[model samples]
Target chain A: MSIEIQNLSYTYDPKAKFKKIALKDVSLSVEDGDFLAIVGHTGSGKSTLVTHLNGLTKVQSGKIIVDGIDLTGKFDAKKLRSKVGMVFQYPEYQLFAETVQLDVAFGPKNLGLDEEEINVRVKDAIEAVGLDFEQIKDKSPFELSGGQMRRVAIAGVIAMRPEILVLDEPTAGLDPKGKRDIMELVLSLKNTLKTVKTVIMISHNMDEVARYCNKVALLKDGELVGVYTPAQLFEDDTVEKCGLKLPTTVRLARVLKARGLIENDCLLTEEEIVAEIAKGGRHA
Target chain B: MREISLGQYYPTGSLIHKLDPRTKLLITIAYIVMIFFIDTFVGFGLVFIGLMATVLISKIPVTKILKSLKAIIFLLVFTVLMTLLFYGGDKSEVVLSWWIFTFYKQQLIDCGLIACRLFFMVLGPTMLTFTTTPVQLTDGMQSLLKPLALIKVPVHLLAIIMSITLRFIPSLSEETDKIINAQKSRCADFESGNIFKRAKAMIPILIPLLTSSIRRAEELACAMDSRCFKDAKNRTRMNKLKFGWFDPVCLILFCALFFVVLWLKFNFLPFVDLTSLGWIV
Candidate 1:
């Protein structure tokens, strides 16, 4: 299954004096099992683009085809939403049920699944997000810690058993440890959950994008500059034109390469750069 | 969706905007009373001229003042229709006669007068809201109600609640918008449903909005406590409200207009009979 977007554009308050162009002529294809990271500066249409993936915002002008289902024409948006689960920024704010289990069961229940099936999905989804289902099931979601509440919120989306999981700044407002935990949970889902094949995440953290994402799409001023693999995106100069900083390890690798201390120009992680440094020393 | 401009203060350095909010409040009350006191067409004409002159002097756009009328347009029409249908007098002449529905010239005139009165009634307070900021209005309310504290009323708390409610309206609307979008992504269908189902669909959005609002209120309370925001009597304002020359001048002008309309209604227009003008039967 793949998501194909063609010439998607959106504008807020289109008829007002303070009209703003949020997205313009953006097109990209996300393949199955691809951990795609969308990186852009603030107001670069990253949030606007992610909202269109699951039919949250209507397509002003363009087309989106998800798994052979065309979203441009009259189609079941509710059915499309079931297939594409979206976790919004601060998803914890959307949790409303009296207990964590009930909150997590919301999506599955909305899908009209049987009660037994919803229960199974809710438990599994909570476990997938690394939350103990039995321990936190009866507790009010509002009483949980910020990190735990965010995990429960993500579990609520995961309970839908969607094929494409889209996250918009899932780790925003979290502590450093919380960020790492959330990212690892997402990474583990890709490896573990057969239902979630494609993961589309909008992130501002270049290091997280470099480490977890296989492909990166750079956007600037509502336009898609290019889509590249993590290594290629860091190695290319187009990333600079997009007004984005290179991941720390990639910048260090470029510096090492400039000093003639490293051979390869593309290095995404610190471990890779350290191995390259050791290899260069052995060669010397 | 940001075109909601009702009851929002227009910031401009004009005679009306510069008037002390206490004086503005009093003038608004006086204008409303005068609108009701007006009975003759000449009196209503004077009140209309006074309203137009205030609008001109306020330097606020005429369209904005007209926009405030849009909110009460339905009320105006309803009152006019009610008066037109139910007003009974010596029905010497009938304008239109139908089965159980009769229109008289006097009833039509009464409807027109009531419409004008209701129109001015809405416009008076709308002008007050347009010219004075919510903060100023609440401050004026607190100051005016300070005497009630002697009778054991919690004036300070009441003012704080009013200000807080006004302050959070826009923020709550923004939060509601966010929650709706978030829930919609979860396949929460809010549009297509029967009335009860549609209301049930709002549970997801409403619950989140409530939780967030409670969270915000708690945070604000904590922030206030940390900043030592208790004891409203000792709290000094950053922008103190002080009555200046403009306030008394505007107050006197409005009082004069009130008396002039009263005089016109009572004594000035005796020669012209309104029923003779084909407006009344």
Candidate 2:
């Protein structure tokens, strides 16, 4: 399913003396099977924009069409939420059931699925996130390690079988290894869960975005600066102008290009840069 | 959903804001006492004027002070309706009759007076909280309750608990918001479920909130232990609470106003009995 946002604006505490404009006339589109990474400084509407996709936030003055459902109209918000599964920052904190199976079954149960179907979905989701269903199914989610608990939480959302998955800072506050594990789990979701057609993630770690995401949307001061593919976004100076840093590999590629070593400016991964450097040596 | 402003401290450079919080606490208590002692309109009028003057002197916006009343509006209206409906005296006369209920003249007057009393009753403490920060209020509370140490009250511990409670309100609220958003994303229906289902649905939110709160408490205890915050007896404050010249003047002014209202309630004003109004006799 594709997602389209148009002319959206949001203000928190609109009547208060310290009203904050969290979003402004922002417009963007996500095509099917696109892994879009939204990057910006804090307080730049990245979270607010993602919330609008699933109807968690009421669209006061804008239009959002998710898989042809106009979100602003009197449509079924809960149904929209099921279609656009959202995994928030520290999602593990939201787990409350007695066992991993129960927690993972929470969403499908809410959907009023039959007992056999819920069990099937729960087992599939837990295994899809790379967890052993038989071992972890009966254990309390709280008993798991931080990374395991996070995977259980993601499995809970995965059980709902959403077409579009929106995650807000999924890897925040995790150790480096834990971050990589979570990112890998998310990257595998598109292939493992066939229903997941579009993935939109809000992330601060530029390296993760550069390494994984195909498309990147840049936002600043509640407005969309521009949307470009990862290579194009890293090459543009707008990333720096918006107080964002390029990924390490992209920055190294830039240095190599400036030194007349590499001809390409779009290298996004360490392996890609290394291969490019090896190619340059053979030509020289 | 951001309208929860009870116990909020408004920062304005006014005399009330600068006065010692202990003095403000005492004044607020004294003013509430005066509100109850007031029986006549003249006495209530005096207290009302005093309250308006204090609100003005505090320099906080009148609208903000009024906004605090929003929380108690239902109670205010209920009090007025109950007092009007149930209050009775042998000398009271019926002013209006509807169905099986009768409205009495004296009851109506008493209801109006009670409503005014309730309004000023809420306004007084709200003014104190508006002008004084929670830290200063708790400090002042600890100092004033120091006298209770002779009676083995654990004054310092009470103060610590109060401060911690105040500090956690905002954090807990922010955590609740985060949890709600997370659950909402998972298609957790909080709004449309039946009453039983809705209550059951709260499990997702309440469990997380309780666990996180416990985790925060544990961390706080550890941090306090690491910092050697063993007992409050040897603790020294960076900013000690002391009464300035303005504090005494403000206290005395409020005290004098209280006495004058008491005196008027007792001696001078001719009590115009509502039964004598002839609408009902």
Candidate 3:
């Protein structure tokens, strides 16, 4: 299923004196199977836009048809949420159940699933997040490490078997190894959960964006600056103009190309840069 | 929740906002005490004028200050109703009589006076909060009650707790919003169903909010401990409270107004004589 957003605009406390226009008139669409990266400077309406995709925030002045569900009026939020699972920033703080199994079962239980289906979904989801279900399912979620707690929180959302998975800075406040592991886990989640057809992530790490994301949607001042492929986004000066830093791989690739060290059209990842150099130096 | 501007700080950076919190605290206490001293209509009128002038000087929008009174609307109406209906007036001055309640000119005037008093009462506190941050407020309270420390009160600890409580108000409200939204995305129905169902729905929001709040408190304790908070008995504040030039001038002005109000209270004759009814000595 695809999502289409049309002319979305949101203002907080519209009648108050200090009303804030959060999102302006913007239009975009995401097709299924696309691993989309939403990158913007802080308060660029990335979170606001993603919240609307799952009916977390009400539609103030826009039309969002998320996976054939119109979120403009009295649509079923339960159905929409089951289609789009949101893993918020520092999601571990949202964990509250006594055991890891219970926490992972919270969403499916809310979906009104029966006992056997919930058990199956909970076990699958817990295992899908790379946690040992047999060993840690009965353990208190609070007793887990920070990264494990975060995984349990994500498992709670994944148990709903949503067709689309949305993450807002999934690796925030993590160590370097933890960060890599979580991103790789998200990649694995896409493979393990056939129901999850699309992944939308809001992140500041341009290296992760360059490495995993197929399409990048840049937002500036609540306005969409056209969706572009990872290669196309890094090929121009748009990322810099939007007050975002480039990935180290893309920067090195650009510097090498400028000095006539490599003859490559567009290089996004370190492996792409390495492969381009292996083909031969431009001076060679 | 952020949209509720009632009793929240409004940063206008006006002259009133610059006054020392201790001075503001003292003057607020005095103003509240003085509200009961004046019984005359003219005196209440003067108090109204004084409160409005201070509100104007605060640079807060007049409507925003009025908005704070919305919390006490029911009380205001009840007070006005009681004063109007229960006034025992002269046998000849009845303005309207309906059912068991009789309204008189004196009662109508008393109703107006009571409403004005209640209106200004809410406005006075609202003005303080709008002009002062919560940190400044607790600091002011701690400084004013420093004398209690000599009697073995845990003054510094009390102040720190109060300060943290104030600091967490906005953050906790923000976290509540996030948790509610997160639960809503999990197909948690917080708005529908019977009362029991709705109350039960709050579990998802409250548990996360409570846990995070406790976690934050623990983290803050650790951070404070690492910074040698235990040895902070002689700790100096960076934004030390000092009486600026406005403090003395303001004190004098307030004193003058207070004496004038006291003079008006004792010297003026009321329209109704409670002494004749033996309610006063």
TM-score of chain B, candidates 1 onward in order = 0.84, 0.84, 0.85
As for model 2, its CA RMSD to the true structure in angstroms is 4.5
Evaluation by lDDT, superior candidate among 1 and 2: 2
Summarize candidate 1's per-residue lDDT along A182-255 as a digit string, tens digits: 99999998889999999999998888999999999999999998899998888777777777788888888888
- After the best TM-score superposition of candidate 1, give how far the Cα of residue B235 lies from its true spot, in angstroms: 6.7
**Residue lDDT tens for model 1, B67-105:** 768888888888877777677775777899989998887
Q: List-wise, what DockQ does each model earn?
A: 0.64, 0.71, 0.63
Model 3 CA deviation exceeding 4 Å by range = A11-21, A251-284, B1-6, B10-20, B36-46, B52-63, B76-123, B148-161, B228-281
Model 3 has a DockQ score of: 0.63
Of 1 and 3, the candidate ahead on TM-score is 1
| Docking verdict class for candidate 3 | medium
The Cα error of candidate 2 at residue B259, in Å, is 2.9
Best by TM-score: 2
* Poorly placed runs, candidate 2 (over 4 Å): A253-265, A280-284, B1-14, B36-42, B56-119, B149-157, B231-245, B261-281
lDDT at B71, model 3: 86
Ranking by DockQ: 2, 1, 3
